[model samples]
Target: MSALPRPARTAGRIFAWTVAGLLLLAVVIAVWVGVRGALAYQHLQRIQTGAAQSTAALAADPSSAAPTLARLAADASEAHQLTSDPVWALASHTPWIGPQLAAFGTVAAASDELLRESLLPLATAAQNVSIDGLRPVGGRLDTSVLAGLVTPAQDAATRAADAAVAVQDIDRTPLIGVVGTAVDRADDLFSSVSTAVDTLSRTSRLLPDMLGRNGPRTYLVLVQNNAEWRSLGGIAGAAVVLRADDGRLSLIGALSSGDLPRGFTNPVVALPDEVTKIYDTKPARYFQNLTQIPDFTVDAPIAREMYRLKTGTDVDGVLAIDPVVLSYLLQTTGPVALPSGDALSADNAIPLLLNEVYLRYAKPADQDAFFAGAAGAVFQALADGRGSASGLISALTRAGEEHRLLAWSAHADEQAIIDGTVVAGQLPVTDAHTARFGVFLNDGTGSKMSYYIDPDVSLAWGSCRPGGQSAPRQLTLQLTLTSRAPADAATTLPEYITGGGVYGTAPGAAEVVGNIYLPQGFELVSATATNGAGFAGGVHEGRRVLTFGIDLTPGASTGVTVTVRANTAAGDAQAVVTPTADAARAPVVVATCGAG
Candidate 1:
C-alpha cells in the first residue's frame, strides 16, 4: 500500500521462486524413480522365467545352465544398485512412502544375494557332480561321487537359507499396497529355494554313510499298502530286508505280515501312557499296525525289534514307502513284469497294487505273495539302473514332498539331520511363521477299503489383530470323507476286500479313525462331527489331539469341522493329512474362518 514497502515485496518474490524450483526438482525425481521401477519389474519377470528354465536344465545339463545363471545374477545385481541409488536413498527418508522405498531396496538386495552367492556357486558345483553321477550303476550307487558334493552343497545351502531368513524378516505391515505384496512374493521364492537346497545338502551329507561307507548296514523296508490305511499312509503288509555294504545294495529276503507272529506277547518297547491309552500295544504287537501311531521315530524301533524276533536279523535302520512312490519310480523304470503275467507299469501300478490284486486273489496269502513279488521286481529294476537318472531324482523329490517316502536311522547324528525333514514322517511342526495341523487317518475296517475313500480338507483363518500384537487368532479345519464304493459292494466285492465282518466292522462299511493333531500351543475350541459321528480327545508329543471315528457304508459320506485358537496370529496356516490312493489333496485356505 506504500512506496516504502517495495524492497520487502521484491524479497518475498525471490523466496517464492526458490521454493517453486525445489518443488519442480522433486517432481522430476519422482517420475524418474517410477520409470526405473517399472523397467526393473519387467526385467525381474524375465529373470524369474530364466531362473526356472536354468534350474530345470541344471539336472540335465549343469554346464549349459551356468551362462544363464550368471546373466540372471548380473540382472539382479543391477536391480539392487538401481533401487539403492543416491536419489532413491534420499527419498527413502520421506515420511509416507519411506517404508515402501526401504522394502524395495531390501528385496532387490536379497535377490542379488540369492542368485549370485547361492545359485551361481551351486551351478558350478553341479557341473562337477551332476545328477546323472548319482544314479545306481550295476546294482550299486557310487558313494564316492555323492561324498564329493557334501562340502559344496553345504556351502550353497547355508547361503541360500540365510538369505531366505533375511527376506522373511522384512516387516511388510508398514509398507503399502504393491510394496507389501512384492515383499511377500520375494519371501516365498527365497523360502522355496532355501528348502530345496537344504534338502540336497542333507542328502549329500547322509547318503554316503547311510549307504554303508563305513561298514555294513541293514534296513527293513516296509512296503505300506495305502488301501488299508495306517496313520503313516497304510499298513506294512509286505516287507524286505535290504543290505548295504560298501555302496553295494542287495535284498536279503522278503517277508509278509503273515510271515511274522501276530500280537507279540509283550510290547517290543515300553509305551508312553498317552500312546497306550489311545493305541494300546497294537502298533508294536501287530506288524501290519506298526505305522498306526503316526510317529516314525517310535514306529521304526518297534519294527526293528519285530524283525529281530521273527528273523533274528538286526537292522540298522527302517524305511517305509507307499505304492504311490513305487508308481512314481515306475515312470522312470518302465513296466515291470509280475509273476501273474500282468505287467506293472506307471499307469497301472497304483490300482493294480492297491485294488486289482485283492480282486484277482481272493485268499490273503496270494495277495501278499503278489505284493511281495511286485515290490521285488521294482527294486530289481531300479538296482539295475534301468531308468533316467534325472527322472529318478524327480520322482523321489515328488514322493518326498507328498510325505510318501519316510526313513529312520539308528545312528544319532544322522537321525538329527533327518528329524525336521519331510522324510522323518513326524507330526506337522508349527512355529511363529506357520500354524500347521495334522489330519491323519487309520482304517478300522480291517480291510483294504481306504482305496475307496476320498478326502477333502479345507483351512481358513479368521481376521487377526494388526501389527505384533500377541492376541489369539482362530483357524478352522474342515475335513470331508466320502465313500466311493459301489452301493452293492458287500455283495459284489470280494469278501477279502470287505473283511467279511471279521474285525467287527460291517461287511461293506468302512470304519476310519481320524486323528487331528493341533499345532503346538494351539487349543482346540470345538470339534463337531457331521452325521452323528463321535469324537474323543487326547494329547501326544505336547500337542492337542482330536480323534473322530466315522463309519460309512457304501455310497455314504461324513465329515468333521474343527475350530482352534492359535497362541499368536500367523498368515500361513497349513494342514498335512494322510496320503491316500487318490491324487494329493491340496488344502484350500480362505480369508474368513467359520464352520461354513
Candidate 2:
C-alpha cells in the first residue's frame, strides 16, 4: 500500500496498462467479426429470397423479373465479398464455426457466378421482347425477334448447366444445421435451373425449322377425344391441318372422323404384327382406331397415311393432344368465346369438350361442328397474341411432362431431337437395370363411356435374388378402375356414350381393353382380376405383355393385380399410364426391391 521503490511502482503501472490494452483489442476483433458475419447473413438471405422471386417472375413475366434478378445478383456479390474477406477466411480455419463459414463462402461464390453468367443474360434477353409478340400474326411470326433470343438463351443454358455442376461439386458434409439446410436449398435450386435451361436451349435450336424457316410445311394436329378412349389417350375424333411458312402458321382445314369416307381402302399396306393381331389391319379404314396400337410412333404414321388417302396431301409432322392439353392451354389464354356462343375457360374446357358435347349433340355432325369451332377459336386466340407467351409455354411444358401432349416429325433431324423426350410418346427402349410397367386402356365399349372411367396403377416389388452382378426380382402390379358415372348412367347418359351394343357389349356398361407391358426379361408368373376376370399373357417388343378385359357398371370399381418373375434387377422403376382427359392420380412407382 505504501509507496516503495520507484522502479517497482513503474513496473506495476506498466503491467496494468498492458492488460487494459489487450482487453480492448479483443473487444474490437469480436465486434468486427459479429458485424461482418451479420451483414453476410443478411445478404445471403436476400440472395435466396430475391433469386426465388425472380425465378418465379421469369416464368410468368420476364420483363418484371429482370429487376429482381439484378438485385439478387448484387446481394450475391456482397455476400461473396464478405465471406471472402481476410478476417472471415482466417476465422474459417478455426474450429466449431469454421465449417459453416466455409460452406457459406462456397455458396456465395457459386450463386454470384450463376447470376452473372446465366440469369442476367436471360433477363436481359427477356427485357427486349414482348411475350405477346411471340405468337404469330396473320399466321406469321416475327422470326427476327425470336432469332435474337437463340444465342443468349443458348449461352445462359450452357452457363447454368456449368454452374449446377460447380455447385454440386462443393462438399457440404462438414456444414451442419441451418448452414446445411441453406446449402441444400441452393443445390436444389441450381439443379432445377439446369433442367429448365436445357429445355430452353433445345427449344431455341429447334424453333426456327419447326416454324418453317426454310420452306412451307404442313402438320396434322389430332384432337384426341379421351371420352372414347384409345391407347394414346383418346381417339383422333377431330383433326386440323396446319400450314407453316416463313415462321407463319395458318389453319388450312379441319376434319372429323365422320368427314372421312367410310369403307375406304387403307393406303398403308403393311402393319406391325402387334397392330395386325391386336387391332387388325382395318385400323387404317377407321381413322379413330389408328392409335389403338400403344406406340405413338407406330400409330402416328398410320393416321398420317389415312389422312393422305382422305385429303390427297402429305403432312410433314403429326401433333396429338387430348382435352386435358386444351384445358392447360386455356389456363394461359383465359376464356375463349366459341362460335356457338359458349365460352371455354381452363376450369370448364375438359368437361365441356369431353362430356357435355356428347350429351348436348346426339347427331355426330353437330358434335363435329362444335369441336371444329372450339379448336379454331382457341388456335386463333393464341395466334392473335391474346395469351401470355410465358403462360402458354408453362402450360405446354406441364402437359408435355405428363404425356398429355405428343409430337412426331417426319424429318429425321427433328425427330432425333424428340427421340428421348416425353413428347415422343415411346416406350422405354431398354429396361435391363430398371423395371417398367404400363397400364394402357382402350375403350372396348366403342362409346364415350371412357369419360366416366378413372384408372389408377401401382407397382410393388418383393425382393431381389441372391448372389449375382444383376439379380432377379419378384414384382406385383395393381390396377384399379373406377366408374364415376351416376348409378342410373344407363338411362341418364346418351345411347352413343353407353355403346348401344355397337361393340357387342351390354348397353351402358364400360368395357375396357387393358394392356400391361412389363420390363424386358420379365415373365408373367400369374395374372388375376377382381370378379373372375381373366388375362392373356404374351411377349411383344421384347417385353412381356398382358391383355385383359374389364366391364364396369355405373358407380362400380374393380382391381386387377398381376404377379411377375423378373430376371433383371430393379433400380428406378416407372409406370407409364395412358394420358387421360383428367390428370391421373396414379403413383409412378409403388415399391422398391430390397437385397435378399
Candidate 3:
C-alpha cells in the first residue's frame, strides 16, 4: 500500500469523513429513540393507573355511581387499546387511579431524561399558553385562554371524573379577581374545587322536597368543648337562623354563644352527647348542615352530613369555611385585586377567604392580635421553613394551584373570580370549640354576659367579644351550637349527650337523637345528618321537637317560632307540620296515632 494517486487520496478522505458522520448520526438517533420510548412507557403506565383509579372512585361514589361508572366504562372502552391485553398480563396492574399530571410532573422532575424529554414539552406548552394565550379584557388581565381554552369546562369535568379524591368545598362564589390579578392564578385551583364539589354533590345523593330545595338553611351553630360542656355536661346550643324562604335568606333568631355554640363545640379529646342534643332541640329545622372543617382534608363529619342530605332529605347547602383563616388571610394578605379590576384584593375578605378554602390553601394566621391560641400547624406545613413570607406565599400559591382550588384563592389578583357571587356563608364554626359549661351566662364559674350594641339599631356588635365568657376554657371536645346574639339562649341544651345533642326522654329505647331547624319563609326545604340518623339519634320517638314557648314581652307582637320535625315520616295524605309562634295556642300533644 504505497502512496496512491491524488484523486484516490482525496476520495479516501471524503470516505473517512462520511463513515464518521454516519456513526455520529446513528448514536444520536439511537439516544433519541430510547428517550422517547421511555417517556411513552411512563406515560402509558400513568394512564393505566389513572384509569383504574377513576373506575374504583366511581364505584366508591354513592351518588354519582351510575354516571361515574358510565364514564369509566366509556373510558375503558376507548382506552382498551391502551390497556393491558391478554398479551400484556400487567395492564390492569396499573395502580388504581394512577398518578395524575402533578404526580407525573413530580416523577419527571426526578428523572433527568424524563424531564428533558417529557416534562420539558409540557413546560413549553404551559409557557406558551401563559404568555400568548393570556390577555387583558377591558383593562383586566384575563387568564381566559388558560381557563377556558387550554382548560375547557368539559375537560375539567372529565379530569374530575378521573380523580381519586372527592370535592367537598365547592365555592359559593365565582372566581375572584383583585390586586390586578386573580387570587387563584393557577389552573390547578379549578381542578380542586370543581372536582371536590362534583364528588360531594354526587356522593351526597340528596332528594328534593316539595320546594325543590335540599335543606332549610345553613345553620351557624356554635358549641363549646370546655370542661363545663363536657365534665359539667352538654347543655344549651345557639343558632343564627337563616331562613331560605324563596332564596331571600331571611335572618331569624340569632342566639348568643352561650346557647347553641356549646352544642357544636368539640372537645380536644372527647366528643359527647351535645351533638345530638343540638339537633333534637330543633327538630323542625330538618334541613341542616355543619360548616366545613377549617383546614384539613374533608372529614368524615362532612361526608356523613352530605350523605344524609343527598340520600335522605334536601338538606340546605353548608356555608362552612374557616372564618379564622379567612379573617387572618384577608387581614394579612390584604385585599386581592382581581384581573377584572375588581378590588376584592382588599374588601371582600370574607368571600376571598372562603373561595381560597374551596381550593385548599394552608390555614392562615391573622397579622393583628388574631389567631391567639389556635392551631397554626396547617399554615406551618405550608410555610415549612420557606424562611420568608414570600416563601410562604410561594408554597401557598403552589399548593392552591396543585389542588386546583386556588382559583378561590386571591392568587394573582388579575384572574376573574371562577364563579363570583357570594349568596351565603358557613362560618367555620368560627373557631374550634372545646366543651364549655352548658350554661351560657355562667362559665359555671358565673361570668355575666355583656353587650356592645350596633348603636344605630342595637344589633349584634361585640356580643361574641367581651364578657368573661368570650373565650371559655372548658371545651369538652363534644360540640353543640350556640349564638353570639339572643342573650337568652343556652350554651348547651339541657339533657343533651355526646357526639350529638341527643338525649333520652323516651320510655323504651336507650339511645338519643338530635335535630336542626328547617328554613323558615321558604316555599321548600331539605335536610341531612352525619354520624347517625336524626342527628346522631337526637330525636325522641320520631320528632325533632323545638319547644320555644315564646313569652310575650310588653308590647311584643312578633316572637321567634321554633319548627319541630318528626323523624317519622307521615303517611300519604298526612302532611307533617312544623309549628311557628302562631301555633303556640295548639295543644303540644297532637296525636296522629302511629299507623294502626
Candidate 4:
C-alpha cells in the first residue's frame, strides 16, 4: 500500500497539529515562568544584600538605616508581585517543581510582610532612640525614650511573629535542591527575627514599670558565686537591695550570706512534695541553698521571705547574676578596682572572684567583704555608664544566653510576660517542636573547688521510628566533668577550697551532684556512667531525673551518658546546663534524626 485512505490522512494531520500547538503553548508558559522567576531571584539576592548592610547600619546608627529599609521593602514587594502572578501561581500546583515555585513565592511574600510591617515601622520608631540614649545618666535611665517605643515595638513584634509563623508553616519535606536550602534559610531568618522582636516588645512593655515608672520598685539582686555550684549556677554568696524610683537606680543595702540567718527552723515557703522528696528542705531553709531547686519562681520567693525576716523589707522582684555575668559586664566596664588593691577585668574577674578570693582570705568574713567591694565597684561602673552602651548590652545579652542573668518578678502580670524568656530562670521547657534537657549541677563537696571544673555536654539524636502518638526518636545526652585541680591540691589549695574534709568528700576532691532532667515525654532507655559508677534515679515534675555523684580527685575526669526515647517528634534539641566558672560552651548536637 503506497498511500493511506483520505479519512485516515485527515485524522493524522489533525492530531499532528494539535500536538504541535500544545508543545508550543507549554514552551511559552515555561519561558514566561522562567523569566519571572529569574527576575524574582535577582530581587531576593538584592534584598539579602541590603538586609545585611541594613543590620550593620542599624547597629551603628539606627536612624540612618531608613533608606536601606525602604529599598529592601521595595525589592521585596517587586519579588512578591512577580511570584504572585496568576500564571506563576497556577504553575505552582504542578508536581515535582511545583513545591519549589510555591516555596519561592512564600519566601518572597514573607519577606515583603516583614520588611513592610515589622522592619520599616521599627526603623521609624528607633529613629529617636539610639544606643547612646540607653546609657545611664547620673545613675538613671530615661525611661521615656523606651516608653515611646513600646507601641511600635509591640506592633513590629506582632507582625514579625505572624510572618515567622507563615514562613515556618511551609512544608519543606517536598522541597529539594536549592529550593529546600533557600526555604530552610528563610525559615531560620524569620524565626530569629520573630524571637528578637518579641523580646524587644516584651522588654519595652515591662522595663518601664520594672524601672519604677509607676512607683518606687525595689529588687533584691542576688550575686551568686559560681565557685560552689548550685542548681541555678551557685550559692547566693552576696545580696544587694537595688532601689528604683522614677528610673533612678541606687544600691540601698548590701549583705553577704554570712549576714543572713544560717538556716531557718522552718521553710519560708512551702516546698513541693516532689522537691522535698528529691532535694529535701535545704532549698527553702538556707539562704545559700535557695537556688538548689533550679526554679527562680520558687527560689525568689524564699529569698524575699528571708530578706524580710532579716530586715523588714519586701522586694518587688529578685534578680540573680553569677561571677560569669560579672565577668561579662567587666568586659564593657574595662576594669574595676577591688578593695584588695587589685583591678578586676574581664580576663581575671572570674578567677579572682571565684578562686583567689577563697585562697587569699582564710575567714569567710574577709571573703565576703572582698566580694562586696568587687560587686560595688562593678555596679558603680555600670551605674555611671562607664562603657559603650552597645557593649554593655552585648555583655548582658551574652550573660542571658549563658543562663547567668536571671530575673523573677513578684508581680503576676510581669511574671507571665517573663515566663518563657531566657531571663526567667525557669527549668527548661519542652514543646512539640523543641525538646529541652537540663544539666543542673550542685556541689556536694561544700567547697569552692567548682572553679576548677571543666564541663563538656554533648547531645545527639539517633534514628527515628514512625509510629505511636508521634515518631519515637532516640536521643543521648553525654556530660563529662573534668577536674583541673593540681596534683597536690589537697595541701596547696586553701582549706575552704578543699571543703576541709567536710561533706564526706576527700580533701582535694570535688563531689558534684549532676542532675540530668530528661524531656517531659521521653522514656529513659538507659543512663550509663563511665567506669561503672553508681547513680540515683527519680521522677520530678513529670520528667525522669537521673542523679550522678561524680567524685573527681585531682586531674580526674568522669562522664555520664543518658540515652532516651523521645515519644514526641521535635526538630530541635536544647540542653540548659548550669553556669560554671569556666566560659560556657555551646551544647554539642549531632542529629542523625534531623533533631538539632
Candidate 5:
C-alpha cells in the first residue's frame, strides 16, 4: 500500500497495545483468585483434622486437654482469617462457585468462634483443676483444694454454654456438599459439644452444694441388686448412708433391706396418682417394693422417705447404682480386696456380686455380709485415690449414659438439674414431638433368676409419613429373654435362686413382668407373646403401656412382640430398657417412609 497518514497508523498501534495489556491483567486476576481459593481449602482441611484430634485427645485424657485445644484454637483462627480475606469475598461473588465460597466462609467463622470462645477457655480452666486434692488421705479430703476449683470450673461452664448456643444458631446446611465430609462431622461434633456443655453447666451449679458447700449433705446410696429385678432396675437389697462434707465422702452406715422395719404408715412425699394406679400406693411397705413404680423419680423419693422413717435421719438426696456401675468403678480402681480374702476386680466384680454370691452364700445373711464388705472395700479404694480420676470420670459417664447410675436430689434447685437427664430416671411426659419407648422388667419369680436372664430388643417402624400427617405408622418392639443358667441349673443353682415358689411360680422357673412403655401419640394395636398369649394394655403418665408375664426355665427362651400405631411422623426412635447386671447388646432398626 501507499504511504498512508502518520496519525492513523499511530492510533492503530495504540489500540493494539491496549488490548494486549487488558488480556494480561485478566490472566493475573484469575491466577490470584485460584491460588487464594486453594489456600483457603487447605486451611479448612487442617482445621477439620485438628478439631477431630483435639476432641479425641480431650476425651482420652481430660487432665491434659489444654495443649491440644490451644493448638486447635490457633489453627481455627488462622483459617477464619484466610477465609475472610478480601480475595475470598471477591471470589464469593463470582459465578457458579460463589455459593460454595460463601458457605465455607460461614463455616470458618463459626469454627473460629467455637474454638476461641468455648473450647480454649474450657480447656484452660480444666488445666487448673486438681483432681488429686479431691482424694482422701487417711479418710479425709482437703476440702480447700476442691473449693478452689469452683470459680474456674463455673466460669468455664458458662463460656461453654454460650459457645454451644452460638454453634447451635449457625447454619451449616449450606456447607454440607461444598466441604465434603468435614461439614457433616463438624455438625455432629458441635451437637455433642452442646450436650456436653449443657451437662457441664448443670454440674457446675450443683457440684458445690453436692460437695457440702452449705453444710454436711447426706445421701442414701441404694445398692440395687439386679439379680432380684424390679421395675426401676433391681431390688434395693442393700443401702448405705453416704455423708459428704466439703467433698469428703464417708460411708456412715450400711444395712440390708431385711434390717429395715416394714409397713411404715407415714408418707414422706405423696405418691403421684398415676403411680398409685399403676403400682400400689403402699410403696413403703417393704424396702424392696420401693422401686415397684417404673419411674425412678417416684421410686427415689419414696426410698429416701422410707430411709428417713427407719433411720430417723433426713437424707439430702438419693443415689442408685447397680452392680454394673460398681464394675465400672472397679475398672478405674483396678481391684479391691475384701476382708474375707476375696478380691473383686473389674472382670470378676459383676459375676461375683451378681451370680457367684448366690452360690457361695446360700443364706441371705452371708450374702449381705459379703456385699457389705465388697462395698466398703471399693469405697475405701476410691477414697484412697487408687483410681485415676480420668478413668473414674469416664466410667461414671458411661454408666450414666446407660442409665445404670441414677440420682435424685431433695432440693428443688438441685433436682431441677437432674430432672431431664438420663440419670434422672424419669418417664417421658406426654409430648407429640418425640418418640420414646421403654422396656422394663420386674422379677415376678421373687428369686435371683434375673442373674441368668438375657434380654434382646429390636425396634422397627413401618409406613411412617413425614410433615405431621396423621398417618398410621406401625412400630414393632420384640424382646427376647433367654435363661443362661447351666443345664443342671435346678440342682447346681441354690434353692432360693431357682424360684423357690416365692411368687407362686414353678420351681426352677424364671418369671418376669414385662412392661412396654409406648410413646404419647401411639395406640396399642396388638401385643402377643411367643406362646400366642395376649398382653394387658393400659395408660400411664399419658402413654400406652403393655404388660405381660413371661416364664422361662433354665436353657429356655421366650419373646414378646408389641405393635403400636401412631398419627405422628417418623423420626429417630429410642428405647430405654431397665438396666440389668450387664449391659445388653440391643439391635436397633430405623426405617423411614415417604417419597423423596
Candidate 6:
C-alpha cells in the first residue's frame, strides 16, 4: 500500500526475478522432457502405423503380405538412418525436433479434422489416382502440425536429421546402407519420404519408362483374388493402394507375382527392428526391412529398353486399386473412356481398368464415402485373412458391386483343351498375371493387340501343362480383331468392350479379344468370319486377317484357323489354341464361336 524503502524494494525485486527465472527454467526443462518423450513416442507410433498400413495395403496371402513387410522395413531403416545437416546457428541447434514432433498428436489431431473436411475431395481424388495406375500423392501425413512442431523445436529437427545420417551407417545389416547415404548427407528425416518421392520423380520414372514392347508393357492391374492369380499364372510389379482417415494413401509395397529385381533375392524381409518400430507392431514385426512396393518396369518404351536385356518385352498396362477406390471412381465419372473407344459404366471394371490413365486431370467426383468401410475391410483382410475371410469377401463383393461394370472374360471350362481355367487346371498354371494392358482398337471395329504377359511364366502340377516352370513363363502375343455390328462398325462391336474394359461402361465389356501368347508361331491361316452373314474379317500387314473377326454372335459359330505350319512334319502339325472355347466367355474374349 505505502511506498517501500529502495533497499527493501530492491530485495523484493531480486526475489521476484529469481522466482521468475526458476519458473522459466522449469518450463524449459518440461518442454525438453516432453519433446524427447515425443520423439520416442513418434518412433513407436510410426512403427505401429506403418505395420498397420502395410497390412492394410496388401492381399491376405503370405506371398502378398511377406514382401510388403520386408520392403517397408527396408524403407523405414532408410528413413530412420537419413540425417539432415542444414546449416543452423550453433545457439539455435536443437536436437528435439524429432521429439517435439513426437507430440504432434495434440495439434495434428485438430488440424486433421479441418484438413479432412477440406480433404474429402482430395481423398476421393487420391483414391482415383491410385486406381488409375498412378501413385496417390499430395497430403499431409497427419504430419503437418508435426512440421509445425519442428519450427519450434529449436533446430531440433536439424540436429536429429543430421544425426539420422550417422545412424544410417548401421542401418545396413549383412546387407544394409539404404538410408546411410541419405543421413550422411545430413538429410532431414522429416522430409525424407517426400524428398524421396521428389527425387524419384525427377530422376526417373518410378517404373521403367512407359516404353512399348521393348520393355515389358508394365501397366497397372489389380486382382480380385491374389491366390487365384498365383495358382494360375502369377504376376509382375503388382502393387495395391489403400486409403486413410486423413485423406492420404499409403502404398502396400509388394513385388509382382513375377520376379524380383537383381540383387534382391529376398523380396520379403521378415525380420523386425528399430526401423520396423515406426510402423504397426505385428505387421511391422512381420515386415521389418521394407519401405515401398518397388515400381518395376513392367512396361516401357521401345527406345528405353533398346539396350536392356529381353528387349521387345513389356507389360500391357497396369491394373491397380482396391474396392474402395473402384467404387469411388465408378460413382464419380459414371463412365470412363477406354482405349477401345468405348465408355465403361460398370463399377466392377473399376478394379481392373484403373491402370491405364492416358491423359487426364483428376476430377473431384471420383471418391465415394461408402467405400471407406469396405476399404478398411480389405486392409483387415490382408492382415488377418486367416481370421477373417468373410469380411474380405464382403468387402470385395460390396466394392465390386459399386463398380462391377467390366466382366473380364474367364476361361471357365474347356472340355477339349483346358488352358486358363483355374478350376479346370493344367498342372497348376497361374490364375492371371500382367502389369498394364496394351489397349488396341480399330474404332467401332476390333483391334490388333499384343498382351504382354510375364516372361517367367509357367504352370504347376496340372495335367494340361503348357510348357512352364516352377517359375512363371511369359510370352508375347499379337492379336488382330475386326468390328462387326455393320451399323457404323464404329458404334457397337468394339464399343462395348472398349467402353467396359477401359472406360467402365455399364453391362460391362461386350468382349475382350486377344490371343494368348502361344510362342507357337501360329498365324491367321484362314477365316470363316467372312462367310458369316453381315460380317467381314479385318485385315492386317498385306493379308486379310480373320481371328479378330466379328465377336461371337449368340447361338452362332465362327471359326478362324491359326496355322502352326507343322513346326516341321515331325512336330506333329501340333498346335494349341489360346483362350479355348470357354475363353470366349471372358470379360476379354478371344475365342471361336458360342463361348462366353
- Overall lDDT per candidate, in order of appearance: 0.83, 0.77, 0.25, 0.82, 0.72, 0.27
Writing each residue's lDDT as its tens digit, candidate 1 over 1-596 gives: 55658888888888899899889989987987777777677656666667666766765677888889999988888888788888888878888777777778777777788788888888888777667767788888887866666787798888888888887766555766777666776777788778887888898899888989899999999999999998888999999788888778888889998898867888888999998877888898899999999889999999999999887878999999888899999999999998889899999999999999988888778898899889888988988888988899889888888888899999999999999988899888877667888888999998989999988888877664332335678888998899999989998889888888998988889998889998888887888888876678788988888888889898888979999896684557778888888645542222321110
User: If the candidates were sorted by their TM-score against the true structure, best first, what order would they fall in?
Assistant: 1, 4, 5, 2, 3, 6
Q: Each prediction's TM-score against the native?
A: 0.93, 0.76, 0.24, 0.93, 0.81, 0.23
RMSD of 4: 2.8
Model 4 spans > 4 angstroms off = 1-22, 49-60, 464-470, 587-596
Better of 5 and 6 by lDDT: 5
Ten contiguous residues minimizing lDDT sum, candidate 2: 587-596
The true-versus-predicted C-alpha distance at residue 114 of model 2, in Å, is 6.2
Error of 2 at 428 (Å): 4.1
Decreasing lDDT order of the candidates = 1, 4, 2, 5, 6, 3
Residue range 103-144, candidate 5, lDDT tens digits: 566667777766777767766666656655555676656555
In candidate 2, how many Å is residue 368 off?
1.7
Q: Candidate 3: list runs displaced more than 4 Å.
A: 1-32, 35-238, 259-322, 325-596
Give the Å shift of residue 456 in candidate 3.
43
Runs with alpha carbons beyond 4 Å of true place in candidate 5 = 1-63, 77-110, 142-184, 262-269, 428-434, 463-475, 523-526, 563-570, 583-596
Better of 5 and 6 by TM-score: 5
Task: Give the runs in model 6 whose Cα sits over 4 Å from its true position.
Answer: 1-376, 384-518, 521-524, 530-557, 568-596
TM-score, predicted candidate 3 vs. hidden true structure = 0.24
Poorest lDDT segment (10 consecutive residues) of candidate 1: 587-596
Which candidate, 1 or 2, has the higher TM-score? 1
lDDT of each residue in 440-465, candidate 6, tens digit only = 21111111111111111111111211
Error of 6 at 579 (Å): 9.1
For residues 1-596, could you state the per-residue lDDT of candidate 2 as single tens digits? 75779898998899999999978865775577678778878987877777756776765667898888888888878878887887777767878778677767877887787787788878888787665566667657766656667888889878877877666555444566777667667766886776676666677677778878899899998998989888778888888888888887888899998988765575364876764665667666688886777777877888788788777898999998877888888887889999899998889888999999988999988998888778877887777766677788888888887877888988889888777777888875434435678778899998998988888787776663321135567778888899987888878888878988777877778999988887666777778888778777556677777888889988888999888775653433567888777764532343543222
The number of clashing residue pairs in each candidate reads: 0, 3, 174, 0, 0, 139
